[model samples]
Target: MRYLMFRLAHISDPHLGPLPEATAWQLANKRIFGYVNWRRNRKGVLTTDTLDNLITDMQEQHPDHLAVTGDLVNLALPAEIANAKRWLTTLGSPEDVSVIPGNHDAYVPNARMKAEEAWRPFMSGDIAHSGPLTFPYLRVREKVAIIGVNSARATLPLLATGYFRKSQAKKLAKLLDECKEKGLFRVVMIHHPPLKRSTHWHKRLIGGSRFRKTLAKHGAELVLHGHTHLLTKDSTEGPNGRIPVICVPSASQGFGNSHKPAARFNLFDIDGEAGNWSCRLIERGYSSEDKLISELGNQMLSIPNG
Candidate 1:
């Protein structure tokens, strides 16, 4: 660990939209379905007011770094992608923020390519290495090695699943080992949860078993993800002990009804050294009745000493 203390803020599944008006041509493909879903359900559920307020509060926290774990766009429309990039600029500069894509980011076949190009800066590592920007990409900030993995993929309509490729899994294991050698706090950021039971059959990660096996072989201090759009806290076996896997509700949602969750995000205050560290997770959100954003929970946790 290099820093005496570090503050990291995490938010996810913004699903940001008020979809840009489209021609019949634009909605010709699978987007036709997405358009209906957005207008009929998401339009009311994910409000810009809530998203703006959440972002305003997040900025006020002034965390050392911010991690947005994907679904930045809704329809993967050309305009939607452009708008999301602009929104990211408002959130923070590439130097202060990092992002990984969710399934929605790659909603259509060609959308993945566009997203990779549009969001490359946020996804790139500090030390530019060889090859295309690949999964298990590492950004070392102070003591934290924020590793980002790509799980987003274009799927058939009504299938919201993700896939963690075997090639990526192999690389991830090596990256985790590297972190252990450097004594950096390893935080794995993926759009989909690595746990098998994390999501429904239709939305689950396709190769989650392999991902978990990689973790069991290597190790990480923490795992943060979204996708499920619910507040989830569970544990998985690490080389040394149990590793905490946490998820927060969608960033743009209002306090949920039956179908959606409210807006929420997490601030992790991290400190201490390699093999001896302390991290306190502070969860904040705007509840259905709350007049303002406030802390919902706080818990002190320790990373297993390597």
Candidate 2:
């Protein structure tokens, strides 16, 4: 029997809102550098227009399954989570999509509960709660296995970090081992990159080294994440060689004056037999006359086995 190939659309860091006028003002007044960065890098501070454009572009791609890595809101406000839920509904049914919480989604003390309440409507199955296994759980398709993990949780005031508790790490190890034995094409998803070198102190995912060791042991075909809000790629060196880890920029971020193209999402096509995969970065923009533009293209890579 021939395994059916599945197409996955991966996007992250939309940072949706219940952004109050005051929040905008605070960003402008106190966080001047962050505000300037947002203006220069992201698309106009969370406008409905940005969401509309993203939804439109994603619809055009017609992904079989959608994976959102995290950071669905700027602040973990109940209302913001509600807004994110609505946006997710518009994208596709929750049954067709999988999402993990990001640092911003769990910013508040009751962040996880709030996210559960807001996001449960779109979640297809049970929320993984048994250690890191609560995430890193599997979504089995005809020929693909989508593994998701939760890396976002509330942290101290000074530290804006992501972490996977020890229990979760152990659970992830078991899950990977079991899935690999099944001969499935695995797509592992986390809000933070599995590699420590890809992150800095303030934004690092605590216990990242331990996590990487587990991932290296189990082996995954693809690893996707979105916490840094910048485009990056790293490889986890394994006994077999290297496994590709791909990070996408913020879906709602703008092109800015950096001359980079507007925000984009990735479409991945997996070959069942050859165990090969191809990806395209699809950019979303507006025409000079203010119409939406969809550009499908390839990104160059220099990795040895990527």
User: Best candidate per lDDT, number?
Assistant: 1
Q: Candidate 2 lDDT, tens digit per residue, 7-92?
A: 78888888774353436543333234433444564546445566567768777878788889988876565567777887888788
Clashing residue pairs in candidate 2 (N, C-alpha, C atoms within 3 angstroms): 128-134, 132-168, 136-148, 136-149
**Lowest lDDT 10-residue stretch of candidate 1:** 253-262
lDDT score for candidate 2 against the true structure? 0.68
What TM value does model 2 have?
0.81
Candidate 1: tens digits of C-alpha lDDT, residues 63-153 = 9999999999998988989888889999888988999999999998989779878888899887776556778788999998999999999
Off by over 4 Å in 2: 21-46, 121-133, 256-261, 274-292, 299-306
Please, what is the TM-score per model?
0.96, 0.81
